[model samples]
Structures are given as structure tokens and as C-alpha cells.
Target: MRRVLAELALGVRLAFAGGRRGWLRTAMATLGVGIGAAGLLLAASVPTMLDGRQARTDARYDSPGGVTVPAGRTTILAGPDGQSGDNAIRARLLWPEAPGAPLPPGVPAFPGDHQMYVSPALRAALDGPDGDTLRRQMPYEIVGTIAPAGLSGPHEYAYYAGYQRATALVEQQVAWRVDRFGYPSLDVEAGAGGTYVIVAVLVATLLLPVAIFIGAALRFGGDSRDRRLAAIRLIGADSRAVLRMAIGESLVPAGLGLLLGLLFYLLIRGQVERFWLFDVSVYSADVRPVPSLAVLAVAVILGLSAGVTLLGFRGVTVEPLGVLRQAPTWRGRLWWRLIAPAASLLLLYPVLLGRENVGEARTGIGAVLLIVALIPLLPYVVPVVARLLPDGTASWQLASQQLRRNPSSSTRAVSGIVVAVAGAIALQSLFGAAEVERSIPYDKADPAFLLQARDRTSTDAMKQRSARFEQVSGVRAGTVALYTIYQKDIIGLANLYIGDCRSLSQLATLTGGCEPGDTFTAGSAEKVITIDKGEINPAPGVRLAVPAKARKATLIGSNAQGVASAVLMTTIPAQLARVEPGFVETRMFTDEKPAVVAGKLRGVAAEIDPLAMFTAMAPEGDRFGPLRVALNVGSTLILLMMAVGLLLDVAARLHERRRILGVLAAVGARDGTVIWSVLLQVIVPVAAGLSLAVGAGTGIGALLMRLSQVPVIFTAGTVLLPVAAGAGLVLITTVAVLLPAVRRVTRTEELRYE
Candidate 1:
């Protein structure tokens, strides 16, 4: 034990002494590890940050004790014409049953009768700089605002009315049992299977780059350290001692890097908090690493550094005379290189082809394995690409020769780039796939605006208000539809037109023309009027029955302008329809912008819920935006680490080739020849790795898109960005790092020393 402690002390002393002599190299090495560690920390902290945000959301939305509505006693507001809006506001009465009773964390207690507190978003809509027109329509006392935590989505708008007023409105309308008393939450109803697959892909994207960076950092200063340890072995150290010494040496820089990483994380925590997920930035406090995770990250970084250092020692066998080197000198077999990636493809085929309904766990494992497979494949591709390069310029030939001669070293130098480029391509392709805009099923060529009422406002009242609103400038035309919930249907129904059949045909898209007094049913073919359920009475004691199966009917039509499972077009007065009291859906075609038109109409009703037609047509920005940002940032970091690793490896190789460079100079070789030779050494491997990466990345991206059922779009911009950026970085690094080192080594003075 004492002897082991002495060896550890000696190893640490040597590391410090080495750093003292060449602090720049030590600092660079530390910086590389530090960047890698920082990435690991950030990646690991994502779950914690999301968890904290969820906790905050739950705390804000969950109610402790409130007037819980009985299961079947809830009232849903529909349009006055017995039609239901697609997104109808639920009516809730918040009166202070106990004035002094405590409320949930974010819920505000009811103020007084006739006055109500609204959600922050609703308040902004009603009282913002442009909300004066809307404020006048409701005319309730502006008391307080509900926090975003109390609602489903941060942008969701909600209304609260005096208990008596809300109750009276419910009594007059179609009232179901109250669902709950707490604020509503924005529920994400996407398939859990798809979400899991996306999440798994995201995790792989983050972790793979981090692993490559750390691996590169561990191998930094490889050649010099190997020679130094070789000398120690010649002096009498055994293999165990040599391994311990290497671990100790690596531990110094790795320990410092861990500290630097922690500081880096702290510095970037604020910026991380600003990163959007689901179009919302989480609270700053939520973007923190958990204590246990922070500790674990440190331990993992340390263990990885030590483990890699010891593993490298396996190539060196210690003897009393010296160390015998068994480093890979010749390419053994090319077929082995295809094994991992080929297996990965086999595993992915089922998922990508949709042959298997594998859950998230299998999908995640497959994704991780696919990325891991790419790492080993890169090194083998180096030699294969070298063989393909035709003999050309002296620089090119020299570079290709070196790649063929010692493929492993060259492969190691650019391995990070391979991983980074491939990952970037895959992510960009995924983003492109995700960003493809979905065509709106509703009318896109026409100008339209939707207006919905709040509280217990009737369709007639909404119509009167809409009539006044149509008088505003920029209004081209307008129509009002009453929304209601029917007892027989699961969804709400709407009255498309209340006038003659001619007006109904003019108002809606119909397959068949109708005459005056002719009754028509409008809905999707799937929900067609059945013989038993088609007896819709347009007026008191007046019933109309259709003799067609609901599924096979041809008179049905679909409209996206408002929420309605089916539309009833009749000459009966809308007020006489057996619709439970509901809100009115007023749609207008206007020359004015939707926002402006909505603002103008807000003053026309107590609540105006504008349909998000444009928003609905847009791609899922909330899901794809944050993912793009994360992948880009992570890829950039990985590329930076690769550049550093390449530079380090080139510097080390140049040091090894100094004598040869000096000999060439002595034999009349020009500075340009030496510089070109050195540049090729780095360039050839980079070209080979990048080529493989691009091909593999594109294939992987296409496969993933197929799995997600998104069309693969290989745009020129997306394809060229990663390649150009990688090539540019390589060219710049070669000129900046290798050129200078080559010029220095080829000097006459350097030759004289040799």
C-alpha cells in the first residue's frame, strides 16, 4: 500500500513538473477535457431541468381544496344555434363560498360578486395596450390575474365570472357535470410511442458527441506520454506501476477539467435557462444540475480519464530492459469494420420499416447502438478511402501515403469530426423533416377570422355585436353560426345557415344544391346522419328524418373554420332549435390583418376566442425549434473539440517527424514541400472521415425520417452546410496549426541538431 502511494505521489509530481515546464500544452489539454466535461454536465442536467419545470407547473396548476364539481354536473358552453365550437371555453363560476378560505398556490380567491379574476393571458388579451375594444364588451371589474402555472399552456386564455352569473348562464344552456375546479392545463395528446422515439433520438444526439469529445481528450498527448512511460519502464517499473502512473498523470488534468467544467456550467446556466423547449423558456432555477448528478458527472469524468489512460497502456508491455510496443501497425482485416454498423442497420430496419411496434426502450437502444457503431467504422474507412485516392500532387500523394501507412493514428485524429459531421447531418435532416409545414385542411385562399363569445352570452347577442363589428373598416363580409352540444352525439353541433336553402348553399360548401324549405345535414361522411339518429327537428313539433346510413351519406361536408361535428341547414329560427344555451361562432372575411380584425371584434363580445388558423397551419415549431438549437450547439462543441484534437495529434506527429523533416531540408527539400507534406497528413484522414460521415449521416437521417413517417427532403442547403463547415474548419486548422510547426522543423538549425 505504501509503495502504491509513493508511486501515485511520484506520478502526480511528474505531471505537475511536466505542466510547469510546458504550461501551454497542459492548459490546452485541460481546456479540451473541460469542454467535454461541460458538455456532459449540460446533457446530464437536461432531465433535472425538465423535472424542475414540471414540478413548478404542477405546483402552480394543482388545487389543494376547492369546490369540486360533481362528475356529471359540468356545463359546457356551446354556440346558441345548437352547434359546438371546436375549442369551446368551459364555464366555471368562482364565487367566494368561504371568503377567507385559502386557495391553491397559483389560484386566486374569488374577489366579490359580478367581479372576476382572469388568467394572465386572458387579462392581456382583454386589457393589453390593444385590448381596450375587448375590455368594453365584458365590462367586469378588473381585479387580478391568474399565473401561467394555473393553466394548461402558458399562452392559453381563460375566463372567470361571478358565481351567480355563471350559474344562471349554465342553467339556461347545455350543462354537463363540472370536470374540475382548478385551472385547465394544456394537454399534449400526441402518440406516446412517437414522442418516445423522438426523445430517444434526441438523447442519442446529445450523448454521442459528448462521448467522442471525452475520448479524444483522454488520448491527448498520447505519443509523448507513451515515450515518457517507456523510459520509466526501462528504469525498472512493472506493468501495474506503469498503469498506475499513467492514471495518476491523467487524473491531474482531468480533476482540473472537472472543476473548470463545473464553473463553465455555472457560467452558462443563465443562457441554458433561456433555451426554449415547447416554445417556453423554463425558469432559471429549474435549469440546474441535481446534486447527486453533479457528483456522478465528476466521478464519471475522472473514471473515464483514468480508464482510458490505463487502457492505452495495454499496447505497451514492460520489461526490465525496456517496454515492448504492440501498437496496431498494419490493417488486419477490413470486413470487421462493417460488423457494428451492419448490425445497427439490421436492428433499425424493423423500426424504420414499421414492421415492429417496439416501445421506447428498444428504439432508444437501437438509436444508441447506431451512433456507437459509427465511431469504430470511421477508423476503418481511413485506409479504404486512401486506396481510392489517385496519385496526384506531391502533397496529395504524401498525405495519402501517410494515411495508408498508419491509419489508426490518422483515424484517431479525425474521429471526432466523423462523429460530429454525421450527427450534424442527421439532426439537420431531422429538423428539415420536422419543419415541413402541414397543409391546412381548411380554406387557405380566403381571408377569414373567427370570433367566439365568453360567459353566458347568447348567439342572438353575439349576432347583434357581430353586426356592429361588420360596420368597422376593412370588413368584407360576415356570418354567425350558433354552436351547441346534442345529447345523442359525443361532440357539439352547429347551425350552418338559418335562412332559406339558397342562403345555406351560398354560406357553406355543398355537394348538392338545395331549394327553399329543403332541410339538409352537413358533416363528414364518417359522421353522416343515420336513420335512427337523423331525426333533427328544426322547429317545434317539426321533424325531418333522413333514410341513409351515417357512413355512406354523400350530402355531408367538412369545414375547418369552426368547431362542429355536424351542421344543420334549415329555415327554422335558430332560437327555436333544441340547442342547450351556447356561445356564438362568428366568422368574417376581412381585408384587415387577422390580429387587427380580432382586436376590433374583441369589443363586440364579453369573450372573443380567435381561431388560430395561421398558427394551426404552421409546422410544430414548439417541438422542432428547441431540438434544432440543442443539436446545433452540441455539434458545434463537438467540432471544436475535434479541431483541437486534430491540432494536438498533428503537433505530436510533427514532433515525431522533426528528424525526417530536418533530413529533407538538409537534402534540399523546400519549405513548401515540408509544409504540404504535413498538411496532407491531417487533410487525407479528414477527407476520408468526412466522406464516410456524410454518406452514413444522410442514410441514417433518411432512415429516421422514414421511421417517423416524415418525408425525406435533401435540400442543397442542408446537405452542403455540414460538409462545407467541416472542410473549412479542417483547411483553416491545417494552415494555422500544421503549417507553422512544419516551417519551424524544416529550418537549417533544426537539421543541424538532427
Candidate 2:
């Protein structure tokens, strides 16, 4: 025990002495580590938090142990007397009576056999049936009125459990698989099958910080313990003992880091809890943190890091004679042997991203690729980039030569910067692409107008207004069907978009081949069905078999096909055959060749300010917007931390090599020469990194746009903004490092260098 304590004391002395000698460097490294660690922890924790909250909400309604409802729970309701018309609607729950206060006197009752309870919101719109008459006809009484807890938009229902529960009950209480949000969880294998996508996002994002921290430790502390290990071994100290000391040193800091992380987590826990987008109070209040999971996760990270780091101390046949000389470079066949397999695994990303089922695989593969790519690639790339800079002033030239001489230093300086920049780029691109994809497809539109109506009664007024608007000069118009998912019925929420099908081809790129005026022929008998490329189950070119006697139409796919859980696209006449005619819709999507819309009509219908919308729809909890913003803010803060690290790296380098710069100044080297050298070495590598980041961001952005259900429009601003921002950051950070060095040089510090 005394020996162990002595060894530990020695480790502490070594750490503190090293830390003081390289305070700026140590701080730089620690800050890099902290930023990476914090970002990863925050990102990972948020998703877990969101998922747990969402899951808890969903668990309230679902069966335990993952049991699911049997198939065939979904059904369509035909109108009375088997009338083959728009009245043959699809509904899930037709409860006994409308849920609310008694109906007004002299109101007409529903004439049909008592079925289906109507929501108070919907029932209020019904101009009939006193509550007593409706109850007498059916036999159920309203215990209380229930509605969606808090939906984001007026037309949207954030809470979907009511519909799912109603459907399950109406279908004889079938045991449907409930999600955390109380919705019937779809078995979508790849796409968002559950409501808590925030968890997946959080978990995946954690990898960036983890990778950054590991890479920083490896690069910054490459030879941190070599001299100590050498000194100990010279005194006949056991290699294992030296290894233990080194591991202890790193573990000490790591433990502090994790504790700090946990503290940070707890500090923000209240803030995080407030952003529950759903009724997550159930999980939030009973905050029974799985102690085991936290312990396990921290232990695993530390163990893996320490194990890998300790491996550097192996093969130490330290001779007393050589203890005074520079330690030999480390060579381990383990890491070298593992490189090929690691690279191969990284290559799986493109394949995984393109796969039909990619939900879990993409995230897992993404984490692996990010971590592996950073560590092995950084050391080799940094020096090469440093050497590649254009020749200019001597300071610039010297800095380049210095970095080239010691590629390890270059690697340390650039690793954190790369991670921070890459993450920022990736996130910005992702969000930007999502925004663009969700926008309306067509760029050319003139005098386009949006008209929203409540219920089927306002159809004539809407149609007449649309006609009047279209008849005005220079207006070529059409309507887009606002098909929202009706969750009550188990059948895919098929919001039938009924409009002039011909103009769709003009509005957007069709996934399957479709041309304008194809579906809008004047009194034509041709049957055409257009499906989007992404539609599952009934894919394009595949024949759909409906309850027979109805003719199957030829598939004519389109890209502008809006969001539909299940889509059956035909002409307006055919659409009316399936749903209610009173719900018929038409929108004049005008080309407006001579003139565009009078105002900023781009994405007018779809432009959702996530923050404002979340509040407007679900004002009960503060979770939704805050949670999302926290993730983004945490990501941004990580980048800022990297910037600070870069500044520290530069400051440390200036101090460490202050004599070299002083000597250069004494030899008549101008301050410009010194400044240029630092800038050239620092700025060029960052620029190169930014170039790679942009290329990656663009390709990934495009892929995400393709995969996303929304219509993303990537403008020059999206591409150039991040790039410009990255370049500016590099420039500012580079200047900050050089200015202080120049000041020292001007003050005759070089004349005193021993």
C-alpha cells in the first residue's frame, strides 16, 4: 500500500510538472478534450432523454414486452345502402355518441344506427342531435371530453393516442403495438417507425465528441509519459508498474472529466426535462437513472481509452544507458494489423446509407466510421497539408517547416479543429437540406394563392374563389391536395390529394415518369396511377389489387407526390370515388410565368418555425423547442471550444518556440515574415480541412435531401455560408496566435535565448 501510494504520488508530480511546463498546451489539450467530451455527452444524453421521455409516453398505451396487434385491424366504411360514391369513407372508430356537453335543443340527431363517438371539437361542428337523443340511440355516456394533448399546428395533432386507442377499441380492443407517444407503432423497418427520433439523433451525434476527444488525447499526449516511463524503467521499475502509473494519470483526468460531464448533465437536467414535447412527466418525475448504464458507459470509455493509451508503453526494454537519450518511436503491430478491417468498415457507410433498411445500421456505422477515420488519418494528413502551403514570408515558411519537422504537433493542432468544423458543417448541411427539401417543388409560379377551409361546406366558396383567382389575367393556377395522415384508422393515413393531376408534372420532378397534362385530360378514359419513388408496400410499376370490379390503373409516378402513409393517386373523379365528395379539394398551382407571387410565397404552407409551432400547439410543456435548441447550441459550443483550443495551441507553440522566433528576429527577419509563417502553416491546413468539410457536407446534404420526405432547396447561401464561416474562423484563430508571438519578438526576447 505504501508503494502504491508512492507510485501514485510520483504520477501526480509528473502530471502537475508536465502540466505546468506545458500549461498552455495542457489546457489546449484539456479544453479540446472537454469540448469533445461535453458535446458528445450532451448530444448522446439528449436523444436518450428524448427517447426515454417519448417512450414513457408511448408505454402508457402499449402492451408490455413488445406484443403487437394482429394484422387486418384496418377497415373501410361504405356509405349506407351500398351507394358506390364519395360517401364510401374509411373510418376507424365510430363511437356511440359525440363526447361533450348536451347538444343544443331542436338539433337533428344522426339518422344512422348509433355508432362512433365524435370528438367535442368535431361534434360541435355537427348541427344536430341533442345529447339525450344521441345517447338514447346509442347507449354510451360522455364521461369526459378528450382531445390531443398539444399538437404543434392547429391542423396537426401532436397526441395521436386518442385515435390509436379509439381504433383499437372499435376493432374489438385489438392489442396494437403502442409507441412512447401512444400511437400505433408502425413496423417501418427503416424509416421513422416511432415518434422518438430525437433519441436516435442524440445517440448518433455523441460519436463526434467521443471521436474528437480520443483523437486529441492520442495526438496531444503522444509522448506524454515516455520520459517518465523511461526514467522509472532505468531504476529497474517493472514495465507493468510504469504502465499502471501512466494509466492512473490518464484515468485521473478521465474520471474528473466524466464527473464533470455528469455534473454538467445534472445542471442541465432541469432544462432538458422542461423540453418534453410530449406528456413526458411520467418519466421525468420518477427520474430513476439506471446507475448501471452510466457506470458501464463511463467504465467502457475509460477502459478502452486507457487500454489503447497504455499499449504505447509496451515493449519498453529500457536500458539505463539510453534513459538519458530521446525515447524510441512506438511501433505496435496491433493497431497496424487492425487498420485494413477498420477502413473496410468505414466503406460500409455509403452502402448502409443506401440500403432499404438503414435506421439502426446507419447510426452504428456512422459512429464507427467517424472515430476510426480521425485517429489514423490525422497524423499523416496534417503535415502533408502544412508542407503544401504556398511560399511567402519567412515566418510563414518557418512555421511550415516546423510543422513538417514535427507532424505530431501539426496533428494535435488540427484534430480538434477538424472535428469541430466537420460537425458544424454536417449539422448545418443537414438542417439546411431538410429545410430545402420540405419546401414546395416548383420554382416558377405566378399569383399562386393558398386557400384553407374548415369542413366540406366551404367547398363551393373555395372553388368559386379559386376560379375567380385563376380567371384573372396572367394566372395559370392549380390546387395541391393537403393529404394529412388520419391516424384513427390503422390503414396508412391516406390523405387523398384531389386536384388537377395534369399540372403536377409541371410543379415538381416526378419520381416515376410523369408528364404535365397526363392525368388532366379533358373527358379522357385513360387510367393512370402515379406513385413516388419512396412509397413503400405498393411501389411504382407494381400493380395494386383492390377489392375487385374496380379497374386497376397504369402506374405514372411523380416526385411532387406529397406526404402520404399510403398513396393512391388518380384523377379527381377517381379520387372522389374513394373518399367523401364534400371533402373534394382543388388548388391552382400557377406557373405565373410573367410574374411570381406578390410576396414571399416560397414554402409558405410548409414553413414551420419549429420553436414557435411547438409552443403554439403544445403549450403545456417547455420541452420540444428547448430540447432541439439545446442540441444545436451544444453542437455550436463544441465548435467554439475547438476554436479556443486552436488559440491555445498557437499560444503554446509561440511560448515553446519563443527562442526560435527571437533568433529569427535578431537575424533581421521582419515581423511580417514571422506572422506569415504562422499563418501559412495554420491557415492552409484549416483551409484544406474546410475544403474537405465542404465537399463532405455537399455530398451528404444531397443524399439526405434525396432520402428526406421534405422538399429541400439548397441555395448558394447554404453552401457558401458555412464555408465562408469556416475560413473566417481559421483566419481569426491564426491571427490571434501570431500577434502575441510578434509582440514578443519585437521586444528583443531572442537576444536572451541561451
Model 1 lDDT per residue over 117-228, tens place: 6665567665566556655544568677766455443444455545444344444333222333334545443442345555566566556665665666566656566767
Task: List per-prediction Cα lDDT, in the order shown.
Answer: 0.57, 0.43
TM-score of 1: 0.75
lDDT of 2 by residue, 1-754 (tens): 8878777667655554555544443444444344344544554454455454445334322323445433342221211110001111111222112333122111223223323433343234222443222222123333332332221111111111122223333242222322222445453223332123333333334345555555455334444356557767888888767766766556555655566666665565555433433323222333434555555656665765576556556534444334335333423234663574366356545533555444544544443344335444555556667656676656666766766666555556565455445544544555564443223333323113433432332333334544554554554444444333223223323333444444343333335444322332211122333322222233232222222222222222232233233333333333333332222233334343222331122112112110010001001112233334645666566556556656656665666566777777777778887787777667656666666555544544444444443344566666676567656776788687677557775556556743
Q: How many residue pairs clash in each candidate?
A: 23, 39
Candidate 2 local distance difference test against the native: 0.43
lDDT of model 1, residue 635:
70
Runs of candidate 1 exceeding 4 Å displacement: 16-22, 38-93, 97-102, 111-164, 169-193, 268-273, 279-295, 318-339, 355-357, 438-622, 703-710, 752-754
The most accurate candidate by TM-score is 1
* TM-score of every model versus the real structure: 0.75, 0.59
Candidate 2 has its poorest 10 consecutive residues by lDDT at: 609-618
Residues forming the 10-long window of minimal summed lDDT in candidate 1:
78-87
Model 1: how far residue 685 lies from native, Å:
2.8
